[model samples]
Target: MNMDNRRYNVNARSLPVSNALHGSSTVISELEPLHRRSDVVLNEQGLPRHSGCTRLKKLVHKSKIRFGTWNVGTLNCKSVEVVGVMIQRKINILCLQETKWRGEEAKDIQGFKLWYTGKVSARNGVGIIIDKEWKRNVVEVSRIGDRIIFLKMIIGRETVNIVSAYAPQVGIEASLKELFWEDLEGLIRHIPQNEKIFIGGDFNGHVGREAGQYARVHGGFGFGELNNEGQTLVDFSLAYDFKIANTCFKKRDEHLITYKSGASRSQIDFLLVRNTDRRLCKNCKVIPGDAVTTQHRVLVLDVCIMSKIQKRRQVVTPRIRWWQLKGEKQDIFKRNLLDKGIWESQGSANIIWEDMAKKIWEVAKVVLGESKGLVREIRSLGGGIIVYRTKSSIRRTVLKPYICVTMRKIGRGTVWLRKKLRELWVKLVLKLLKNFIRTLRRRKESKIFIRLPRVGKENQEI
Candidate 1:
């Protein structure tokens, strides 16, 4: 009776007061669950309605090409074996030094092709090996003696020059060393500025651990202390605006050192590219234990070519054949322009010029018509050879060895002529000998001075 009397007295004072008190308790109960929960939620109906922060996804299209260099000591018998290592590492182009393979020749081994140049004696030589995928793209191969060799190839609308160089040792003659550098510089100078150049070889120098004064070319992360040869290399890089690719990335002593023998270890080999193309080089490091040779380790460089995806639609504007506007077509075009009142247009000079141009284009389109475009057909001569026919003459580009001896013997007219003459002389001699033998066979006792072997048991007289 006492509790019921107190509740009835509180409610009798104000009905609204009791209702407000009940609503506050309900709100507290709802908030208590929200405070205990770990998940966060936004208001369903609000001014923003969504988050202010946004997530972005990036779309990047890039093609990667791997370049490597090694001093194989001698590549005569190990051609197939070294190619195996290249395939395993997925190297597209490789530079070899001290190949000791005499004569300039292009040999194919296990799908990989090697273009090498050396002297008569098997001593120092340089060569470039391209993978099967890129072998067909080679357009030109230039051999600068036995020390330097380079090739030009087309890779995705870009022209790339790959050079393989072998510098002389420290103990070599000073004059010869200078000559080598001079030849290298000359080679680089002749290449067009638009093309990409990658020089990978055993430079036989140490750029030091710090860039110091050579910071422009050296990347501050190098091996060993700087020497005279290293300074020469740094000077060359400065002159040509090149970056020592191997020194650009930070690496441990093991990966930084390229040549190791006994307790001696140093980074003598290097890969270089133009300063403008430095961004294309993603990584450069030495691969240990996978050595095809003993002293020098394999240096691999990762080059990335970023091709932007074009999103805009290409608008091919129709080109009117203005040359066709003659005789009746020319009169028709003039009449249409006059009928359009292009010359009588009134306003500013810009307005009159725009009207005139529009009228002329419209008249020309109706009178002359658009061109169908030029037709060009490219023919392949098989074996990496192509014949390009132009308005003047047909140009032949040889990328690899052709099956035909005459085609392969191009550029050596004297040698080819001599070979043909010798072949003809041999055929004539063989024909005369065949006739003499036939005469001897016809006469049973004609060969009394010399006895010929019996052709068969049925005709044993000869």
Candidate 2:
């Protein structure tokens, strides 16, 4: 058997291979090094060879602010728990629906502050919870009934208006749904175009997975099928030029579904922003595992503000002890003014008022020094009134003098005169009793006997 010789004589045959395969192999080889490297290598122009199709690089230095929306069913005893979750998630601002907390007020839980609005009955409420850092930046909070609330805050140079809306459920009355839409539209219309608007809430409508006619507003990444209620939401987005952030990014089914109960799951809750500012959103998804509620999941949106926030510097301007002018410092100040020849100066008539004012201020500074701290001394002829030097302090001083004058006028009336007469009568009766007791004790010391006056049985003679 010569099988070894036959195998050596066999020639290899060439087969047709596609150029695409060859090119892909070369591309994969080139990308192998990049995949192994932890950092991307910049090209000659100082940009990655294959930069992603995103403008996020421009905001590399900016910080991401996480905003979330959740339908908690009822905050009742879970407010602290909700805040705890928010802190863990690092969400800066959170829009809440179905708060079930009555009244319109802000409550501080841990480091978060919740501004909620509701009616007398504990149902269908909305609120916005902001972290401690952003609490001071809040300029206004507008509560519209129990279903809608608007929070305006300054972030860097931009004015951000966050609207928390709870739309009527799918089976709710038609009139109520229309009213909600109308109110929402009016709110958006009133917001200045230059400001950033973020409307986050439980919209209670599924936008579906298909954009169809709503390609501009719906991002085609939603869950479930579109219904009448969903159509309304899409139309609203189209009218307001808002991009439904929930459907903007592709994600797994679990991450796209916001509401799950029993055997049903859908994407009713949504986060929306102006279409023009869509690029500012880095990511938006439903956190399925971090469940604050039984049915609804937290839908979070990461927004990167491109503007750099400049820290405000507090200028502590020295305040003159003007109250001292009412005391001995008055004479000293006048003498110093005269000594400085500020008013006696025969300067040119063309001298500006600023220069003359400056000269007077200089003389006053030397005579009555600036206040040392918050404490200010207000001297009267009788005594000194020490109070904190603040606007409220001035208000109190003004009101106190007016109140004293009012009391003086009132004291001259008949009622106050009767009160004074009653007081004087009590004092006279007590003084007479004391004098009589003293006389009796002196007489007893001299062993003198005195006959007491007879009186009625009820008032026995002493």
Candidate 3:
């Protein structure tokens, strides 16, 4: 019942109910708190031993990298919500199918960049969204078509190729399906053997729970029954020497099923990785409780990758509280400067200025204190947190002669109020102009009628 021991229940999800009562992988030995040193546990050999007396054979020093695939169905007005899901779930990269955004360029959404490929009309669009931190490392991006997009990034010492694809549905024409496979095969064959590859998206297939002769490509933990489309996926994986990561891990029915309807459930989404780097994957499962506006649930794959640590630069500036020198404080500064043998001054204009400045600095250090350190942080749209430490306060050192004279004549009483009112007026005018321009553009795009002549009417007759 304790949340701190939730990992104990995690292991239970893998074991059968009968195995839990029979102590298959775990022997509680004692029901007391887990921190107790005297609590004895049984090892694999059925030998009683203290919990702390044993050590694990290996320790993995890797970090988890989350990759997700989702058939969002449409991305017209769902950019914010979809990006929010990626951030909340800590997904490093996500492949979105059926984006429904008509564009062939990359755009910013929240703290992520969406590299989408689609035609003028919104249909069969595919995109890949990556964290802003990784954007700089992307070396190449190829927009194959509305159904496929490729991106390559330099991760550590290795180059990783990520392919986001949306295959034709089962009911599509056979020629289109063949063309999709041909394009996919060309992409795979072009990549070097040394680099890592990850292909993820909606394959629209049911691989079933049997590997048959394609055991190297398909794992036995698949969901639903194998069909012709699934066989095509298996053949493609075998040809490219890739493994279907989603079918490698055993999960509950809810986790195994990726697509669900009112009463039908199946798995159509999948993730593929190189067979040699199979150990890089830690787990693959489907996440529930998504908005569920679409029938496809979110499929996630956990991979291990090297962590990137960047050194941050800190800047500090010196600040002096000039306002502290007033009345008696001003007189004291003058008296102190004079006392330091000011009568014995003899130098050129520059030398005299330097000496006087040095003396003033020493005197101020004794009379007034420096400003406290202030840290300013700015969150960038690319998902990086940058902090700036100011060493000194920003003080105006120069002003126009007219502005200074006006301030002196008007006094400080109404200066602040006048400045604020002027700023507000400028802002109001700018806002009105912006709204008018926006309305004009909208009307122009919509071809709304205006009291203006049509094309060539000026030369002809109105």
Could you say which candidate leads in TM-score? Answer: 2
TM-score of each: 0.57, 0.58, 0.55
RMSD of each: 31.4, 29.9, 23.3
Query: Which candidate tops lDDT?
Result: 1
lDDT of 3 by residue, 115-175 (tens): 9998755579899999877777889999887899999988866678989999999999999
Q: List where candidate 2 sits over 4 angstroms from the true fold.
A: 1-61, 308-462
lDDT of 1 at 234: 92
- Write candidate 2's Cα lDDT for 169-197 as tens digits: 97899999999999999889999888999
Candidate lDDT scores, in order, read: 0.74, 0.72, 0.71
Provide the lDDT at 359 for model 2.
77
Summing lDDT over every window of 10 consecutive residues in candidate 3, give the lowest-scoring window.
378-387
Model 1 lDDT per residue over 1-462, tens place: 553243222211113225532443223334555334322122223222123311122234576999999999898778888998998888999999999988999998888899999995568999999998889999999999999999998876678999999999888999999999999999999999989999999988888999998889999999999999989999999999999999999999999999999999999999999999999999999999975688889999999976554443434344677767779878888888888887798899999899888888888888888754322221122212222323233333432222222222232446676567545533443353455556545654223121111111211222
| Candidate 1 wrongly placed segments (more than 4 Å) | 1-61, 308-462
| Steric collisions counted per model | 0, 0, 3
lDDT of predicted model 3:
0.71
